[model samples]
Target: MIDTHAHLDFSQYDTDREQVIEECRRNGVQFIINIGVDFQTSKASVDLAEKYDFIYASVGYHPHDAKAMTDSIFEEIAQLATHPKVVAIGEIGLDYYRDMSPRDIQKAAFIRQLQLAERLKKPVVLHIRQAMEPAFEILRRHPGNYGVLHAFPGNAKEAAEGVRMGYLIAFGGPITYPNSQGPQVAASLSLSKIVTETDCPYLTPQQFRGKRNRPDYVRFVIDKLTELFPRYSRDDIVRITSKNAARLFNLPVDDSPELAYMIGKSLYLNLTSRCTNNCYFCPRNSGFHVAGHNLRLNQEPQEKDILTAVERYSGYNEIVFCGIGEPTLRADLMISLAAELKSKKLPIRLNTNGQGNLIAKADLPSKMRGLIDFVSISLNAQDETTYVKICRPQFGAKVFPEILKFAKDCKEYGIVTIFSVVDVPEIDIDACKKIADKMGIPLRIREYASD
Candidate 1:
């Protein structure tokens, strides 16, 4: 597994740095990202990356160093990022825990680095501690392509927010400690939005407490992760998180047929491009892409056209009811078409806004009983206020209550329910979890699509 985060640039590893790298290699640790906290360490990080194949570097000034940062420093960071192995531009963001740097300086430096990452087209490795709400404010205002929250400190509520923003949360050693409440919150999140990190020489897991951390201890993090998240295998964790890291950092990956990812081989029937909500951050307006696939819909396809598309990929894994618009808006045609696919014994997956039950004003979940193998619903917010601001639903607050009811209905019908929330900056993830847990269904927090 990749230790996507580490700070070998610190003096903590000065005595036996080479030995540490050797040990990491022996332990099957594929990669280690040595993050920089300032200009000097950032350069050292880049230098170390150049000397070793397995070690990559992330160049940025930490919040504590923000007070000393200047415009020239950003230029230097941009230049250092030109190094081939430099993967990100952070260890940036706020740290209310120390407040060593002035809040104003921290914010300015953080925003500057964010702009640098955007200009460099690189992902950031965030380090927010006891400042999620304010950190989120900066994030919402300067929503770039993507980044990760290294050692996230908020509850499931914050995790959901980060996930909605298309950011991955990197869990370090503290997760193994029995008393670490922050790590506990992270463990409860979906594996898709999580990546394991050692954050070596700091935040050591329980076993290595009071001892200097090492890259080899990544296994402990994975082992604990497996114990917490039983649905995922060790290999699955490596695959998913690595892929997410690769995507966020824009690392070139092997795209062989065996490695290429697709939700299913099924036909994805395009319904409509029009949406009821005009979310401020919706890709439909800013950038129309999903999973790197272009999703620019010019004209709506007729039912016959959709059926023809389905017939073309009939040997697929399944037929998915999905599109940029609400699939249920064409509910009549969808039910009829789904029935046709069912007759052919084709599996079906429905991606809906979950307003179908309220829109049709009927028992929609039961209507999907045998027609769908899985139903993925968008549970975008924790409360109605944020929901209105983020989703901007045409139906207003009505959509929020209706979606929750829809989740419960889907569970009762024995349909595989996926309750998805977006990574908007302000939503409460823990509250959403309470709702999902009460209803007894799986949850997915979607990353915000970027331009």
Candidate 2:
């Protein structure tokens, strides 16, 4: 996993830098982001990153060291950032713990570096302390996608603002300690809004307290994370946080086309791996990849977690109910959630099997009339026999009639209904379109994926 924030450039690593690197590699730590608190440290960080392939760096003046920042410092930082290994602009923000640098200087330096990060198109790793008000003000003033509040200690409202500004909240080793409120809150956030880091040489977990924290200790942080979020597997957290780190830092992540991707902003959910029907050409079973986004949700996330995900993405273009499982299975929850989102005027869409009515044993379209803006249903087969053969639905002969009737019902209810037929060899495309036309609804052809 990407460290995202660390202080290997500090004197703590002078004696065992090489050993640290080796241990990091052995413990499955992919990258260590060496951060700088001043010009000298920033330069040192860049030098270490240049020397070690697995090490990256961030260059900025920490609030505590803001006293040393000058106009010339910016030029030096700009020059150092040219290094490919330089990923971000901080470890920069207010730290009222010491207030070593005067408040004025700290604000000046922080704002300057914020502009620097924006100009460089790089993320900033923040070190906000008790100055949440001003720190948040500066962050909101410069809204960009590349930033994270490292070792985040803000309240839920502040965290919401950070996410709205497109920042990930990273939790470090302190999260593993018994009395650490910062990391505890961070761990409870949606997995999509969280990233894991060691913040090595500092903020060590309880077991490693007063000792130099290392990259291997990242697992301890993850342990605390699992204990807190509990919704995600340790592996899922690793993969997801690694991807988030890679995206924000512009590191090379696996760009395989097998993944599903969203163009702009949208709230996403990864519901389930299990499906009621085994459609021969459906990607739901093989692995539902959303372009570069993986939708193989390991477990059913709690409604609270789902709502958190929705809240984290409320600033998006829309919140879509396209998850690995049929959204209808969680119909009651989805409908209730849709009403909440409706209160916020958030657009909502449902990617379904077109059997919500059958599953709920009621009129779903009318039930969801004002709550859902769009309904996309899979109409993989035109007739009962083809439906049974292709979909292998649990409902057998009843599936085809139920789906067609549901699609028609959705259309009649004035909902934007889309009937989709997977492009499989055995499934007649023209027949599916004819069925859609007969129902007076729009038709779509979905790609037949392995699962």
Candidate 1 local lDDT, residue 43 = 97
Evaluate all candidate structures by whole-model CA lDDT and list the values in order: 0.78, 0.77
List pairs with backbone clashes in candidate 1.
156-430, 157-429, 157-430, 164-422, 164-423, 165-423
Residue-wise C-alpha lDDT for candidate 1, range 1-451, written one tens digit per residue: 7788888878898999998898888888877888999999999999899898888899999999999888887788889987889999988999988999999899989998999888888898998988999999989998775788998777888888888887888887988898777556766566657777888888888997989888789888878776775655565566666666666665555432111123334456667766777777666774454333334566666777776655544335667777667788777777877887788776788888788877777887788887777889887788889888788899988788888888778777888888888776777888988888877787888765433
In model 1, which runs have C-alpha deviations exceeding 4 angstroms? 182-184, 252-255, 259-451
Residue 67 accuracy (lDDT) in model 1 = 90
lDDT digits (tens) for residues 29-146 of candidate 2: 8877888888899999998888888888998888998998878887898788777889999888998879999998899998888888888888888998888988888777777635
lDDT of 1 at 6: 88
Error of 1 at 60 (Å): 0.6
Instruction: Report the number of the highest-TM-score candidate.
Output: 2
